[model samples]
Target: MVNCKNCGTNITSKFCPDCGQPAALKRIDAHYITHEIEHVLHFERGIFYTIKELITAPGQNVKNYISDNRSRLVKPIIFIIVTSLLYSLVAHFFHTEEKYIKSVDARTIENQFVITSKIFQWLQNHYGYANIIMGLFIAFWAKLFFRKYNYNFFEILILLCFIMGMSMLMYGFFAIIEGMTHTNLLMYATALNFLY
Candidate 1:
């Protein structure tokens, strides 16, 4: 047993002199390493369920999350972190190279890409003003249709994230499906929506 010099507490382990400061472990044991890996795996499983619930029922999931039993759900920031990383990864891989787009259909896709990219660029450049714009849009829509709920624009922003997160997840799923089916379902639908 070693007495912690700072706190004057006696501990058998090397960790605390007396105050329980972690003492370096002597054994770099395989069992300890395996236990740590299993713990991480188990923690990640809970995160997966949280994401699943959030995407499946955005409004309800968020409402419940912010409710009394809050810790049961993953934090909103964590959700955003995970979704943002996945979205960036998917965009990097799935998006076609700009130079390769030459066909009529490719041109159409390129145009849609240009429009969406410009809007995102504008939003990035003016986030504060853009938030106000988006906030007002949300507030107006909410007031028009959801008067009973009594949510404000800021609340709408949270809801929008939930929706967008779900959309990104769905987009990833559908992209995979499109790849497997060898059909341009996502592209055709996107074109129709823009054309209409």
Candidate 2:
């Protein structure tokens, strides 16, 4: 028997009994890289599966994830980050500019609220993190309103993450349509997102 590299446990089989680390670790190579990618994007139990579940039956899927089976769904935090990043990339690719902010004198804005402007710019650039911050605020309000429910604040945040992630996907899909058609559909997208 070999010692487990991860936890120094004696291994008698393919994995470590104590730590579950593989008996033999694969060297980093092209095959390893390909396998890792497949592991993450695999259709059966990866992001695609999670997206399908979220889209088809959001309420029941989330309920199952929170209560019964966590493995079937992608982790809530990762789901939000991946979806938000996807939306950001698609928006950038489509050259979609922020609609509200138009032709403000940088000097005056910076001089008035340097920190606030910086924070806003950062949030605009990094949507994944920005969405998480937004989710925290949303989760707080949801928790307050649904105090009768048994779920805690963190659980509510998980629900928000799944929901916000799906919303980001919706936005990304709309961004694609807008880019292809070369027509401004921001209002329609926003309305549909709210309805969703």
Candidate 3:
């Protein structure tokens, strides 16, 4: 006899005595229900609005948001969400060459590193591409200039996230220009950076 999945009582009926849950689970539907659609719409609206505000307003938005008495600006988590979206768009647009030409007498992971660096360089060129570089500067500035802030390094990181998040709006604008021009600024930036 087939045993009841729920309550583990002997199979007499479909449901078990302990609880009224189904003994046999129903198969999942191919299409999601309206409830799922509502949930997705709700989530997407929040993200879209947040990205719009964050990208458009930057510092003013952050100041009026995290400090002032308003609740409409995008949350901090949205920064990561939009960043991931930008990364996804970049990944889709930038396809690496899979074919590797064998060197005369040496085999190294140089090709893979080059490809990875290219992607990072591309991202940096577009999104304030100098974000990490500027971040280091900001980090140093916070250490020395803001010595009276009385905050630790970790606290500075939190502040930097906001500062950089705001600065990244500029990066996004440049990304649009680069995308339209069909030119990768990263190539030039990489050359200059390497030369230094």
Best by the lDDT measure: 2
lDDT of 1 by residue, 43-69 (tens): 543456666676567567777654445
Candidate lDDT (C-alpha), each: 0.54, 0.85, 0.50
Weakest 10 consecutive residues of candidate 3 by summed lDDT: 96-105
lDDT of 2: 0.85
- What's the true lDDT of residue 116 in model 1? 64
Model 3 alpha-carbon drift over 4 Å, by segment: 1-45, 96-145, 150-159, 162-181, 187-196
lDDT of 2 by residue, 103-194 (tens): 33358865776666777778768888988999999999999999999999999999999999998899888888988898888888888778
Candidate 2's displacement at residue 184, Å, is: 2.0
Candidate scoring better on TM-score of 1 and 3: 1
Ranking by TM-score: 2, 1, 3
Please provide TM-scores, in order, for all candidate models, with all chains considered together: 0.49, 0.89, 0.40
Give the lDDT of residue 126 in candidate 2.
80
What lDDT, from 0 to 1, does candidate 3 have? 0.50
Top-down lDDT ranking: 2, 1, 3
In model 3, what are the clashing residue pairs, if there are any?
Answer: 124-129, 128-171
Q: Looking at model 2, which ten-residue stretch has the lowest summed lDDT?
A: 97-106
Clashing pairs in 1: 3-17, 4-17, 4-18, 15-23, 16-20
Q: Give the per-residue lDDT digits (tens) of candidate 3, residues 131-153.
A: 44455567677888878866665
